[model samples]
Target: MRQLLQRLNNNSLYVIISLLIFGKGLGFCLNRKFFFYPPQFAWLMNNVFLDYSMMIAGIGLLVYVCLPSNNNFVLGVLLAIITVLLAIITCIEIEHVIFAGEIEFVQNAISNSAIIGFILWTARHYSKR
Candidate 1:
């Protein structure tokens, strides 16, 4: 049991980061048909730009985690930042869902939860290290 827990802690970062990226891909997959984007975002100005910008930031954090030169401290900080950013985004999306009746908040909340879990897991792992 102890060894299994240790293994899980060591791999937590990779698991959470993969979930984050997978969430993004799932969004695109659900809203796309035959390689074409759904019309859902066509009415919003700069929607694609905003979406891609968020994706870039998420990918950049994943890249940082994957780099060999980083230690647990740096990785933990990055994870915290990503978690906070995702929390804020999740709140914004929640507000939109409440006021504007948008339906995409569920996925955003799931992503945010994963990010928050990652931060918590990182803290525990760092302490154990």
Candidate 2:
């Protein structure tokens, strides 16, 4: 039963990550029309090439970690990178809020925080098993 729960948890994590990748891809393709945040946040979404690169990097790391003969050290490094990226993104949103004096992107900031929380939780959960 313990092993079965672990397997289910791992599969669900992958599904969540896969959905994030798909959503990022769709937003990249749609540009400003994606409308997750606002027009101000549109710049981040509009850069399709950069978005694609970041998304690919993340997914590639996940794939490498999930391979049959994967190295645990590499997986740990990937998780660290993911955590740092989430932190950087959250910081950027905070910086924007500080400089622009606009509360419009508050929702974006909160959403980034949630993503960071999710990533951190997943990292901790997987590290335990």
Q: Say which candidate scores most in TM-score.
A: 2
* TM-score for each candidate, following the candidate numbering: 0.50, 0.62
lDDT of 2 at 12: 65
Which sections of candidate 2 miss by over 4 Å? 1-9, 25-50, 127-129
What is candidate 2's lDDT per residue for 53-100, written digit by digit as tens? Answer: 547656765555445444667666765665565566567667667766
TM-score of candidate 1 on Cα atoms, chains taken together: 0.50
Best by lDDT: 2
Clashing pairs in 2: none
Q: Write the per-residue lDDT of candidate 1 for residues 52-126, one digit (tens) a residue.
A: 544555666555544445476666665665566556556655655676666666676776677677667766665
Query: Which run of 10 residues does model 2 get worst, by summed lDDT?
Result: 28-37
Residue 124's lDDT within candidate 2 is 65
Total clashing residue pairs per candidate?
0, 0
Model 1 global lDDT (CA atoms, 0 to 1): 0.55
